[model samples]
Target: MNSSKPERRKTREVRIGSTAIGAENPVAVQSMTKTLTTDIEATIAQISRLENCGCNIVRVAVPTKKDTEAFAKIAAQVNVPLVADIHFSAQRAIEAIEAGASKIRINPGNMRSWQELDEVIACAKVNKISMRLGINEASIRNLKEDTPSRERTGLMFEEMSEYVREFEKRGFCEIVLSAKSVDVNRTIEINRKFSEGFDYPIHIGLTHSGLPEDGIVPSAAAVGSLLSEGIGDTVRISLAGKPENEIITAQDILASFGLYEKKTPRIVVCPTCGRCMIDVLSLAREIKQAVQEIQKPLKIAVMGCIVNGPGEAADADLAVCAGSGKGYIYRGGKKLAVVPEAELLAEFSKQINLLVAE
Candidate 1:
């Protein structure tokens, strides 16, 4: 009910096991497992970690027969819906469907033939599971060598359109479509086209986004841009590091647009400057750790100086304006108390509990 939330693009709802995509549902945050699918126990453990971190759907690579076998065992043990990542093989896709995949991602550009696609589609229809027509720009074979960036997107869109028509022709409507590019602008442009071109739920993200430190900005720009325009139904941040980081980063992007149901406190801290009096950075760090167990949306601002402190406090549910040896606490933009620096953490914890109780 927040006015800050974007008006979501209305699309046909598709159920992936227990999770629903599109319609009025909150934008789902998803991540792929990094562990080898052949390691069934490790895959299950990773899925558990992802579920604990609020991943709505967990994808695992089923590129090999052994991987699909492991996927079946892993799917049986996890509560989260499993998506089989299939590439180059319709047999693998069919195996994954029989292996209990709630959804499967296959790039139509790479499929050998229409018959193969039809076979995969028929299996998914019979299994009553969903499929993702995932189109990665890099995989489009017809793209001429040294094609311009703009032309590349056109080719991507063309490939996706052909596949979509095939899927629809086969009466396969339980589909989620994705057109991904590593380039930020192209990623946004392609997904926008998908939104306008089809009523299927769109999964948005950049593929091959590098390590976390370097990937976050571009990932945010590509994903956050689509989300702001009400374009994406589900998102993956696609960092090169841990998949948990991917989930966390995706949640942060969704939260920015008010599309995520945040179960953790929202911590806002000022970047301390020369005008700051107390150790705002230290205090903010302490507050972050102290509030780890909080499971509700609480805006706690830790400001270093008087200049921006009061202004930020007006918006935050709870705020601390630090002075020389003491800190001023604000609840609902009204001054609650002034506590010595030593008791700031203790006093702030007390106030947080009271607010939570209320």
Candidate 2:
């Protein structure tokens, strides 16, 4: 019953195109494009899809100049801010920066030397682009060198700190820090250390996760753990399937903790038992599909039994407690009308639609 809000960590704000992240801004939800960045049309279409799903920022991979060429056009056509994912290649990072990337993600462990970093940082500074110093576990040399699992977070912290210091030394302070591991505990610990030591915004995610269907639980666990304590600024749910699914996954995590900006009715349906009447499961599914796009913050309840229905849904904006062949509609615990079973869903839909319009 406790709904205490978590305190967010204060960090420097970094701008990506038109979007502002960190500095206690509403935690931004982001996802990546799965299509090859060289496929300009498909990449733009996917970014548009993610934008429609309430995604705040989107990252696209730029492994080569061709992708950056496509990225230039993609950035011109899309409204959401774009981050170019660059691996160890400094040349590619510079190219993506020139092509209009609002932000660039670089793995600190993968970079060869300070000179290589200086090249990319100089380019980012000139272009006025923010940088995400992504410290990934798999890419880290210490982790690959038979480092004990328990010591990985420490190594990540060390690596991230070194990169952040380098960025500052070069006079490029528009930095966002991220430390990601497949293990949720490591991800949480590394970010906690990062937050305590620096004021830069931190991006949160798991580097390698299972397939989309199987990835949500762990990805949510890692991201939600950090965000709940106010340690994360931007989030990406790294899933193994359609990149847009990552947006939905990220939304579910942020919404569970009440940190997301995009709001809609969250309908609660009773898991029916023998005390139940009416087909609550079918009705709930249909209503969920219908209201997926509504942005208004509303709580709805579809209960199969009348005994604990209205009282349980007392906080809901709208509710329908169904009986054997009739249903009672309630608004904020006050009954409005009785309707036949077949019309219950129809009436409930109309009531919520009216509420949304209001």
Candidate 3:
């Protein structure tokens, strides 16, 4: 399916500010602002950078009235839709809606009573905004003691399903559901079960995926698996780094499944072994740095040996198959030249320049 088009899961399309999610829409990439919500300029700058990095949506924390005030100003200035993250307060949720938030994220399981939850839903309906109704395991009330893995994920499904129905009962349908756990497999499983039981759009991501280097794999395995199976409509890779890095990681996941077709560069490096004579890792690192800013959908491969390198290089737009003392250059899958090891960088750079120019 990576090489062919996939039949995406169908769900009711819901608009989040200027963009739409669910059936027939591209799976949106979103990230949160790391700056303080009270600092309008800093928050706006972060959102602008994320936008430049191709983030489809941005969320900001609104834990105080001052942040809510700043949020309104930021919304008025930014081009992309902003989602207000609300926790432990319903009045603040109402205030955020009035402040021009395109959507609001609230975990109903965290609410002490349905009274406040109902009021928030009413506010969203009145303001014509969308809601991301989530049921985080940590927030669930009175979770059955010593629950089995099956029952735990099922509980998540039940929590999300019940919350969604309650919103529908109050005549609110512009909803995106989420059920996440720090456990990657559980995140994947719950999202699938949640999707099968409802037609509402689902927002998928791992809860508190740690730092970038360690989080990338778990985030991808959870979010990427769902997207590949026609599950996620909108996504965020929750990481402890620059929010823009989350955008990069999310886009990379979408791109891997052929779901995203943005002008981003991709690198294909062979896992070097004893067969490798030249320094493959160092060359690949340099190549990664060199093409970081390239805004073209180019595939560059760095292979270690002629054994499998040439065959793999045949599939890239530009590639180099390094042998003992020389490297064979490939352009558009055809052998262009065989250069000495000392001249490999120059030849690879030349081919890349030509590709970019085209």
Candidate 4:
């Protein structure tokens, strides 16, 4: 049989806290905290929430000395691995590692000079911590005020390769690499080019991907393309909204590609048409909320018309096909019973519970 799955890239395994990244491990989900890191209570609460929502790694910005001091307290309260995002200053990177950050992320090309780079690497080696060499088009120094688009991407790739080589030569191979650009195609191309040359795990995302609704589509397109090609070992769905929304969007993107295991009922609802009888939109919303706490992997279909509903949803584990003001429950394409509109939510929950019990 012919298969469409992308061939896996061979990479060395690196550990972030207790989570093992690269090698044969599943691609991990990552998110950054928007809260001020110095606010111990707020940062811890946000990190706890992200962990509950299936975030595998979390990054906190260490922009100042205060933030570096806060890492010790924040590290004590969170369960997932913590990475300190440092820019320009190698001293802050050393401070954060000493304070117990599991990893530190810096652009090796843009960070200080060779002496400072060695300082950062020495601290990381002594602490036994991992690092991410993040190089982006926006951070590349003095390219041109108006360089051509094509030339800009090429420069970003060249700069990233230099950093990758530097990290490798220093015996600091526990690194993750990212080459981000606002342009989706450029982001994909740079990572693909780097994958061909190195075995370091690539952290993939399109930077500054605007608001939730608009940002999600482009971010998903970029991430999905790379993941489909087996080019990403970790991913972050960057958005301009609440960080929790990023977690939800990331899960949805993975689910769409069938990469994430369906732990909850996968609801398949059709767009209502003129021939629709029941309030399909409202019913689908109600059913989703009603089964929000269910953790079983079941497929549920909600269709507008009865004629094609059951047939179309035959593959679903359970389904609801609407008539005038009523609906029929289907179990594997066979009708089990008629259900009133008011009781649809309850009925679906009851069936899910039965499945869970078994």
Candidate of highest TM-score: 1
Clashes of each: 0, 0, 0, 0
lDDT by residue for model 3 over 1-358, one digit each (tens)? 1355456899999999999999899999999999999989999999999999899999999999998999999999999999999888898898999999999999877776899988888889888899998778776755776877788898887777788778888889999998878999889999989878999889999989999999999999999888878899999999997998898888878877888875867888899898997999999898888888898887888999988887778778889899889999998779999999989988888888888987
lDDT score, candidate 2, position 220:
81
Question: After superposition, which runs of candidate 2 have C-alpha atoms over 4 Å from their true positions?
Answer: 1-4, 144-146, 261-263, 289-295
Q: Model 4, residue 349: what's the lDDT?
A: 74
Q: Distance (Å) between predicted and true CA of 280, model 3?
A: 1.4
Q: Clashing residue pairs in candidate 2, if any?
A: none
3 versus 4: better lDDT goes to: 3
Tens digits of per-residue lDDT, candidate 2, 216-293, equal 888888888887788888988988888878887787777777676446677888999998889899989988887888
Q: How many residue pairs of model 2 clash at the backbone?
A: 0
lDDT of 1 by residue, 119-179 (tens): 9999999999999889888788677778998888888888889888888888999999998
- The better candidate by lDDT, 2 or 3, is 3
Judged by TM-score relative to the true structure, which candidate is superior, 1 or 2?
Answer: 1
Best by lDDT: 1
TM-score for each candidate, following the candidate numbering: 0.96, 0.93, 0.94, 0.93
lDDT of 4 by residue, 88-119 (tens): 89989999999889988898776759899999
RMSD per prediction, one decimal?
Answer: 1.6, 2.2, 1.8, 2.5
In candidate 4, position 327 carries an lDDT of: 79
Task: Flag clash pairs in model 4.
Answer: none
